[model samples]
Target: MTSAAPTPHTLLTPGPTPIHPRAVQALTRDMLGHMDPVVFALNRDIQQGLRDMYGAAPDTFTALLAGTGSLGMEAGFANLVESGDEVIVCANGSFGHRMAEMAARYGARVRLVTAPLGEAIRPEDVAAQLDDHVRMVAVVHGETSTGVLNPVPEIAELLRGRDTLLTVDAVTTAGMEPFHMQAWGVDYAYTGAQKCLSAPPGLAPIAVSDRAFARFHARRSPTPLWYADLDGLRDYWVHQSYHHTVPVNLHYALHAALSAALEEGLEVRQARAAHIGQAVYHTLEPLGFRHYVQDPAQRLPTVLALRLPDGLNDAAVRAELRQREISVTGGLGATAGLIWRLGLMGESARPAPYRTLMLALEDILGVPGLAGRFTETLTEIEDAVPA
Candidate 1:
């Protein structure tokens, strides 16, 4: 007996987003030794690409950590928070809460400034939690769990001119949204290769402002994690010194992905993301799915969390979609079993794949004309927006 052939999945999840064609092609290229001169050159290129995408200051230190986005989160806290350091974490969703937990684990005196799930964290609330003892303020630019985009700029303004450093988790917003680290007074920011970057997992791109670097340099205690030490990473990435074996193929893929993103221009890519997000929202609303994030301004265009219609079993629906070769994630933490987390990120943020997804959903939900309505609506949006 012959087994069934495997199917390709259209990934529409919060992370490990669809990889770009250029990145996929790069992954197939011959590998280079970790210490090869060409590898260092690729590191420089990746760092520069990150700086450009983040609008980082000229003196910023940028590098890629050989881990997932969670590692980036740990690096931010480990490098900056010393024992007894007062840190304010803005917890509006699951990612924000993770930062709070991580900060505490890193020996910080963690103070949580929280907002309800699906709502943007108020900058004033963060400001209220601030004190002279506060050493840093951590916020997630895009909360993947709830589809809420927090006001990082406003929160940065609260830390401006103060000794406090502002670190942002841009895991979902890195390539999808406009992020001006310098202008926004962000001291540190990090993202995953698997998100809007359109590269595969196993790399985390991080940016460190001079202010943040200085704080790390002044830490009385040594950083806890040897591998995550920014100084060691800097020596490896910036000074071409060996620290560990860098994943050469992932680097190649990331370099190609960044090159493609830059070639397309961030403004154009952002416009496309916005267009796709709106298209998804409009197409799904009439099908009984409701946006979990009530405020449109606070919603993430990359990852959308939608509350399922009454009587629909979340796991069963997701399982059905997966069987159809369409993969979207379910809600996380408190949102589990109540919502669906859909992503239209990077290479997946296009009309055709979403059309396929809609058609599949139509079939599953027994809605006869859903796909036609989606196509007509998308055409109207494309004509209006030119994405």
Candidate 2:
């Protein structure tokens, strides 16, 4: 009998990035009852770790839901946005558009402020969209589509002193960048375990400020989604009230992932991400390439959006890279076919793989002089990777 071919797995995508071996082992740990004291202790530790990761206060209503980043987004909208309530959504990429869609599903009157793909939304533009009727202002901290980092701090400053709640999607920015929930005045924020956290996808790490919790308390109508209801989920996660079955092993993995982040230190992790991102840009820039987002300061460190070479097939190049055991991603939504989304996130966000990708691309594209430059870039990057 012929043996089945070995399965291959290479995740260089923006999300669901490569998981650490230790975290994967944590997932195989023995399971416990969700309400067990041991489980509760694990839960508490994870919540505190999340707060530390986000630079949030201890009293913040932070919880982990058993789902991807989208589940957290739904939870935020379902709990905070009531039917017919007006919300201002800033859309520059696919995830921003997704936030608006989720709000609209919750019966929110979504007033969208859009910027072109690969562009950042100016705070002035957001202020122009604000009205007395708007209850919440939603924005994506790091748009994975075009690798543009929106000006959350500026937008938050603009919304200060106003009754409007500020919600942010930090899915790609959470562990990879510097995000301070309390300092930034973000009322609610959500991220996934897969991206910068370097864990398997499933658990959504969510944080809500005291003011956002008060809004939840004052809600007159029921949340549209049952599983994503913050009130109910909070009861189970924080208050220890049984609502549904919690994934015990997944929680183990989450706790381990957070522990890894704490060990690495948030500042160090952020710097590492930034360093790798800059290395990638510097390596590509001299090869007649341009970034999708012009401003380097406003780009996401975890995801890089590069313009495809003239006359080169973007999809074909991605496929070629895959054959070499690398898996970069394509653009999302409106950016499809226009850019390549290279993720330098988590475990895979290192020099070796990135250098390998560059060399492989050079070999395939027959780009003269790339090999030598790639070698020099690799040496520089290797020296820069954290000890």
Candidate 3:
């Protein structure tokens, strides 16, 4: 017998998070020309929304680059790193290594301060590696691969009074976590529209401090190429001059997503995510599952990395969940075969996905009655929040 086309899965992976109906609706609006005044205004609104969310300084430049988060990562490096200059890459997981790789491609001397897969990078390790030649310091705010939130504020403080630029990869945590760009001293911060932003994948939103722009302005040579050049992007996004044609519809969608987040209030939204993440921990802990990141403070609210017990078939469990149109993921790199990654992001961070996913996990893992137990616990947690 043939089953119907698979139902829309509750997207529980980190990237390309579940988009809100409002954002999807925005995508269906009439397409505008890139040079249209309407699109220019929408693009400007998106950039302004980003700056407001980050609590950035007045001069901090915010814009949406065409590609996804990785493109922003490259742009961050391409604009700043020159040949033979030094950069400190903080590698506690996959994204950090990617930053280092981008720096290398731009001919910067790379120094890595990495922790184990499930641990956060130490601020002192970053401090110990600093020197006069270090032109930039790159760190991932949320290391999704390990479910660890790096100590970006502490790391930023370490770079205080130094001439080095501070760049953060906030792809997974932008809207879900508390963002304090001005107070945090982050020189250049970037996030993808896919994850916490809850928009369709494509746009890379970035915030750059004045100091970082000066470094780019004073570069010894022109930045690598036309597409991802920060200077050109700034001219178009900031000055409203025609640099390249943008994805007009996606900008509207991105604007919708950002506006929805801001309307909910960033602090309120972040607190809700925190509550939901705590609820997940409470629900899963009783079923003999242990989190990969031991320190609670180091964990990311968006992604849950769980360590299953012996004899459990990780693939089979994921397959069972997939059968029900649930889309939790597994680990990568050093964590392969050892963990399951359940993403609690944007729309998915609410109770519905958590309820469905926990029940499915109970059925797969043979945890009798634990799903019922989880429902009760999560209900109490949610009830505490004032609607």
Candidate 4:
């Protein structure tokens, strides 16, 4: 007798949301050698896709690093920072603090410009801390931990005409929202494939502006990390010389994912994310849930974090959802046990998955009409959104 069919799972966590079907198909295809001419063509296509996603200049350098988003973050600091160089890190959520920690490890004089947890960093606050000595300013476009969408464009504007370069962590916002690196003057930016791109994890796509590349070349000391060295990476990505074995299958998945994203249009995805955010907020508000981030403008539509009601058991609820094959994450670090992060990204940022979530929550919470309310809210949001 055949065993029972495997249970299907719905993923709503901030990272590694449901992989797009095209990417899944791509993953199952036959592999290619790292240095195959076909693989090189695929890589170029992926680079062009990334350039479009970030609105980068034609000459901006892009590469798919074989690691998670954190590697991209580290690479940004590893190449541009040196001992005794002052670097300003804008910190609000867990990821921002992680950036500060990474910068400190690189021997830079790390200056942290902070906001309260669950709040976005203020550009003016960052501006106030800037000085000629500050070599670079690092900021997060979407803080996954707290769902705060920091104003990178405004912060980039603040650094204009300064000697300082601006680096952005766009891990959660890249394909789901507007991110024009060239227009905003972002010197460097990076994102993971698992987030808005709806590809499998283990790939970090990065873009380096010409200015940032010049700074990379002008470093006072040799880059300490060989793996993350931008110059070495450029040799592999642009010059077609092997620095390491490229993850050909992962690139295949990313290529398909990018093709799907460009076909659907990024602005349409952004609107869908906004609709999801509104549906979640309105549907859960009646059940006594409130947003973790108070300011709507500062909240990320891609990741809506909600403060759990008093006396609610976070772990128990999440576990129940998990049992039903739905995955949602709880708070991290300082906000532990207080918030639930519901990711509406890429393939998961649609009505079907959200309806599944609402039904499960209704069953767990004993709210008789929660699912119906969610459907109504979703309808209202869709009607309001212009075609």
- Which TM-score value belongs to model 4? 0.98
* Each candidate's clash count: 0, 1, 0, 0
Predicted candidate 3 versus true structure: per-residue lDDT over 234-342, tens digit per residue: 7788777889988988898889999999888877778777777777778777666788999988988788888976777878888888889988778898788798877
* Residue 193 alpha-carbon offset, candidate 1, angstroms: 0.3
RMSD of 1: 1.6
Instruction: Write down the lDDT that model 2 would get.
Output: 0.85
Model 4 Cα lDDT, one tens digit per residue, 128-219: 89988899999999999999999888898988898889999999999887789999999999999999999999999999999998998898
Q: Tens-digit lDDT track for model 1 on 129-204?
A: 9988999999999999899989988888887779999999999888876789999999889999999989999999
* Weakest lDDT window of 10 consecutive positions for candidate 4: 378-387
Best by TM-score: 4
Candidate 2 displacement at residue 239 in angstroms = 2.4
Give per-residue lDDT, candidate 2, residue 276. 69
